[model samples]
Target: MSPCCNWMWGLSRRLVLSGRCQLSARHNVDVHRSFSSVPHPPRVCVVGSGPAGFYTAQHLLKHHTEVLVDIYEKLPVPFGLVRFGVAPDHPEVKNVINTFTQTAQSERCGFFGNVTIGNDVTVEELQAAYHAVVLSYGAEDKRELGIPGEDLPGVYAARDFVGWYNGLPYNRHLNPDLSSDTAIILGQGNVALDVARILLSPIELLKKTDITQCALDALIQSHVRRVLLIGRRGPLQVAFTIKELREMLHLPGTRPRLDPNDYQGLGDITKDLPRPRKRLTELLVKSALEEPTEKDATRWSVAEREWSLRFFRSPIEILPSKDGNKAAGVRLSVTRIEGTGDNSIAVPTGQVEDVSGGLVLSSIGYKSIPISQAVPFLPKQGVIPNSMGRVKESPGLYCSGWVKRGPVGVITTTMSDGFETAQAILEDMKSGNLNCSESRPGAAAIQKLLSLKQIQPISFSDWEKIDAVETARGLEIGKPREKILDPQEMLSVVSN
Candidate 1:
């Protein structure tokens, strides 16, 4: 890229980013990293490798004049959601990794992966060592339905299931019984639709994405059909991206059919909804009216057969199958929509009804778990609070990503949040607000944990090894990629 191009990229980067880093260009004459003076550059440590961390590092490098940055993550990989959360087949979306990688290449931009913040390091330690520490760790735990039998054998959490297939470390060990013939999904969110669509789609169709090999094979052997995704609100209030819904129409061999009556009730939530919805609403109507064209390929497609999601229903009870212990169906209490479901929300209130299924998945929401109490932690909301980006309770501490902004928004929003946090740190440093103390964590227990060589801290290099292997394996099968769902296996690959 030319100097002007680089300048444009850097300038555009600054407008949106805020959380971690200080900028110093690479020395054309191989200039050494400098420190140890009153004029020494700022040092930032970002916790988490998600989009927020990446951009936090980037904006600081490009815009700020003097600073060094480091990123820390519990996983051995970089690009948090790009690697784990995004649907793998969406390679275009995953392209964001290239930008993040470039930001991490700075000699000053360090990545400390596989290091648990509270365990391997502490919040206080970060405050003393680096000029600033930004937490960009995202939500991994799934919210419960707060209903009975939810923890039973036949039931599952959608976040856990998505992670299992997506190769997320927390829930990679999940082994779902794919032998069942029908399934139930609760929630009206986009994630809910994703779970239902993935379940109903054929394995061959799924192979195109970076779904785990184990998940794909299990899906190939899966006997499921007639997936019933239950929602507490009506279609207008459905919390899914229309583009994703449109993609569901094109899953090879599976049947997808939306109810004719469902469209009569779509609410104003979409009055001006952008992105996939603008196109999604059109495709939904066109496909229903038999008028789809090639232009629809950008975000949607007409289905050979399609799946359906029912609205205005909350799960009342999970009915086990005849043999017992296996999910058979869910009994629902219908709701009433007082007003339009989109901008102004309402739901249908009606009599109880029972829908049959062999599996049940709850997809209400995602939340970040508070790290063990060795550091500055939040009392409620399960996150460290901040003002735009600075930690409210701790000096020299900051946060970004879902943990910083709460569990919402797309990965793009994380990039913007990171930039914001980095900028705040820069302003703090300009005013000489950084604290560089040397208080060691005083615990033999902390010492033992650090000395355990068995635990490998994953870095960018380690993640590359895993990615290389998965990509190579995918070539053999003519798919996007196949993920390793075992933690031991992943660790071994990284360690080896």
Candidate 2:
């Protein structure tokens, strides 16, 4: 054949051998694979077992047929906030665990608990072992009040208090003194309301919940009969949801002690507010102005415990007891609103008030801490710098949940955030923005490293063993589940 004809024939043969041209030959499968370009299945590591991490993994597994996901948790157990941060009384909120359990049981997904991301394995190592690493560890620290006497004996961060009651191993020994008749909470968010309700709820009501045995015992001896929820803004600016507000109002043995003055004109303006805020404000106005129902009135008449809301009050200092050791009260500066809605600022009115209380809890907020210097974190915002969950300036690195956004919103908000991150990962994979040519060892390599470090990662079945033990122990009592409050104890259960 002529030179030109031979060149054309060679080009066509090359294309056919490269799998561009399908042939019905038996050897075509092997021939195509030898010359075909197919990337390895992407391996993703999520660095939290919380809702955010699980939801992200769930989305990845659902959308990608070949994606491998491994979840790493610092605790021996899964479900970070669901297991350790949610209020014991709100068991329904924790039902998300069922969905997470499904994800963990997926053949393509793996759960590695008792593996601290930054400690057991660095972010750099995880990136090396996986095609992508998602940092969803969430905000583990509380926002400080930055007021005097904050470190007083009787003062505590609401996160620690919640953790103490929820069986968090770190806060399990926080035996808060409950000898005082009144407790002061510095914040008007749902967490503040939860703390208030738990403090004032009849012991019989809490006994059935999964509250830590230690906390239950403390509550049994608690003399606290009054809870005061203080907010830095007016009633219209309160941050709590209507459901939480209603729960506090309808508390079995507690009565509302709201100031009528605070709700004086709220009824007139509530109609103009947003639906949620309107309902919350209307409830406040009705509870303050209108008389209670006959049954409620009778209940309140004999109720010995009460809760009150104090607005336009910013805690300036925690007053110390006579010994100057414990918090006896909170010194608040009366403030007036300067703007409207979320932009509204609490401006001091040069007026101060001292409300007496023996125990003080600050439920201001939770903030994320930088897990490693390798991750670019904005300390002021308490979040990793990210664009739609893609870590800025860091390829193959992403973040979700409170660490991607400041600690706010509920579980549904977190699910959306996790989905967004998963979408970003999928987009990167499709767009070739994420290099997936090289196969990753995923959890296999990491397990070797963990073994070398003497860190035995707890598997999902092992965690189930711990769960079964806790459940059996709780059945011995009337509670839902008596949590194993010690990491060592949890590991022991798994080991045995």
Candidate 3:
């Protein structure tokens, strides 16, 4: 055992003995005596090394003096979605990685990558080996469009497409066919905007990012000239924030096409909306009403690609071509909002419209899956049932991020969620609800189990080696670090 494990085990044994003595004395004298010696530190196991898990660990370490945290990740690499889900062009968003790196470097923290909880070890096993177990695995499964012809060849999910270009190992072979001249994305979130931007951006811009070489090469040969972003509600109900919208509006070589009529009633109510929404709606109105400058007219005349946001349209079905093998168009049902502002709901108008498009992508949202039988999951909501981040009816179990709440919000939201969960853990410890007096081997026991199972878990140092190699390789190609798109390749990089 490592020296740290030995110290934890020894300290735990002493605390257990001291607690037993206090209990005996209290029974004999009918008086309670406080055990002055600091209680054994809690050993926490956090599943998933995403922002949620890292932030949770950070807060736990900050609030607790001697607590030990171990984060387990299924992938050899860390920074779950930040590394694989964030758009490559938005490198600023990835700066959180530096903070996460500091958390991993904490003396009381340990990272066990390439260790899947449900497969290599079960949730019950983790709970047995630690005082508290936190499940922040996040939402990996995506919500389906559930419309007819969704399985067509040219139809894809935005999640998989984003993963493909972002070098998610599982989607490395997606190799989507971009031979179509027009593409339709059925959602109006930031992800939808990202897809539109990637499809319309100049190839030289994407080449400088960390986007996979395969996706970049494919984009260079893409025939896509038009992208249509379809949302179920009106412009006032757009889910994307202003930053993403502004980026799309300013994308070079791409003309924004919004029907001026869509902005007719929005101008009168902009002031009544909240600050964020008001600003966003104002930008949309400006873009819609602005007349083209002489320079803009010249650029539009020679523009090779364009993107438009189509409101009040919900996808009813994907229409296949005569061959019935590939997507040729989309059938949308016209929708109208019943209420104003965020409470607005889309109601179908019974009128149908057909928009011709050879390629389609559904970017609705993501869903969380139950990792193990031990976890109580709300299937309808696709989240773990929790009360303020504490797992309901399950002691020694907690959850954060999308698994605790629903899959929504930005990175800052997730950080706050993680901190809340960590606070819950600290409260439980202080209240003696989390009994840390008994010794638990923590990561040492987990390591033994993994060794017996022949699973060689990757360490943080190993991931850094892989990171160095990827960076060096990218430097040769005049781009940001190119990602290893295969698990085996990542492991090999770490090994060498």
Candidate 4:
């Protein structure tokens, strides 16, 4: 028997021992020949082309000998966040596209782009067509600050700002104003640091990046010289990782403006913190307290731009200019921590301060919204309630990644999450929990449905054609690739 078949036999025995599955005479015969006796292989469809979707599909295809995986994406391209969300300078992170490409090239795997889930087809239809349907269409929405004057002209969500520079078609025309001398970012996460770095990075440094042409043009004309990253919690509770913090500390042509008061006694407690936290805190203290090297001292003496970290501050409103149209500053409430460690709470101190700035970007977090009414979702938590990747009360349907958990963790977390979901499906097949007795049409049925709706799905090869043109365009300008900034243009490229 194949390794998969062997695993199924072992799983059957384990299920029996656990008392969750009863191996009757009929079940014993069925489980023994489950892999070989099935009339057709299991067909699984993954919704979304992001890291979670590709990782889930990769797992299924690798583990199951006779499984077919189809990845559906709403855009004309594959590798969702890798193509749209990663920083332009961080091209190494985007290398995961090579792994995802290998998965898409598998004979048992199919890629269908430009196919929206809720609009193109319903979850019920997918459930009918595939033995298992996995929803990995990660969080696409942004959380708002909900403060007064949030709608001001100069205020933009960090999601939109990042998207604007990263070549997301929806934000191609963000055209953020950079005429101000100062900018305030209302979060201290890695994303907030990314935004601040891009704002302060020299034009020469940005010219070589894959950042959108429009964003580069805007940055060239930007007068912004200083940026402040505000957070409600202290340094210990910062959401950014050590690597991101180190990047900011070593950013070229800029100097750190950390307050000496913030580092008081931080070194004394470093020994009690976790390894990662301790290393991060030590770096923070060194940057703030220790003397700078000769080269850094020389660099800082003539630095033209600067960035600062401001703690115990929460934005209550975006202050408007004299004409009351664009943002003039931010009204921040002074805050006090009520507990110790990373889980400490920030309580308002009943005091307020206004920091002047012409631009404000909110980097709180990204959120997930319900894709279809059929899938059960918890709005307050911004996630689907699932135990072990299996949707509650919904057999043959599952979810992974941010939709499965909340928007947290890194790419490795999503990979592990996707693997767990695949394992759950495999276990179900072994125990006859997932009904694979019937052969489903999978992508064929989905294609026919799209044909009826007059929507043509873009294939992986079609995306390659688009990629070639973008690469060719980028080569002319000495960039990685000049991304097609409009969805319509992408479809046109695929059609040609």
Model 4, span 1-496: residue lDDT tens: 2458434433432332233123112212111123434468898999999999999998998998888888998777889888888888888998999999999888778788777787678899999889999999988899999999999999999999999999987788789999899999999988899899999988888888888888998999999999999999999999899988988888899999999899999999999999999999999999999899999999998999999999999999999999998999999999999999987999999999999999999999999999888999999989988999999989999999999998888888899999999999999999999989887877777766865655666678778988999898888999878889877667666554
Look at candidate 2 and tell me the lDDT of residue 224.
97
For all candidates, the clash counts are 30, 0, 0, 0
Candidate 3 per-residue C-alpha lDDT over 1-496 given as tens digits, one digit per residue, 9 for 90 to 100: 2458435433432333332332222122111123224555578989999999999999998988788888999887999999988999999999999999998887778888877788778999899889999999999888999999999999999999999999987788888989999999999999999999999999989989999999999999999999999999999889999999988877888888889999987888999999999999999998888787788777777877899999999999999999997999999999989987789899999999999999899999989999998899999999999998999999999999999998899999999999999999999999988888897768767766765555666778778988998899899999889888867667666545
The reply for model 3, stretches above 4 Å from the true place, is 1-39, 292-298
In model 4, state the lDDT of residue 330.
98
- Candidate 1 residue lDDT tens string, 256-295: 5566666653334446656556556655555554544565
State every prediction's TM-score relative to the real structure.
0.81, 0.92, 0.91, 0.92
lDDT of each: 0.68, 0.86, 0.86, 0.86
In order, what is each prediction's RMSD in angstroms?
A: 10.2, 13.8, 9.6, 11.4
Residue 434 error, candidate 3, Å: 1.8
Give me the displacement of residue 227 in model 2, in angstroms.
0.3
Please write out the lDDT profile of model 2 over residues 1-496, one tens digit for every residue.
2458435433432332233122213111111122213457788999999999999999999998888888999777999998888888999999999999999988778888777777668999998989999999999989998988899999999999999999987787788989999999999998999999999888898999999899989999999999999999999999999999989989998889988988887777877888988988888898899988999999999999999988999999999999897989999999999988778999999999999999999999999999899999999999999999999999999999999998899999999999999999999999999988798878877866865555566678878999999999999998889999866667667656
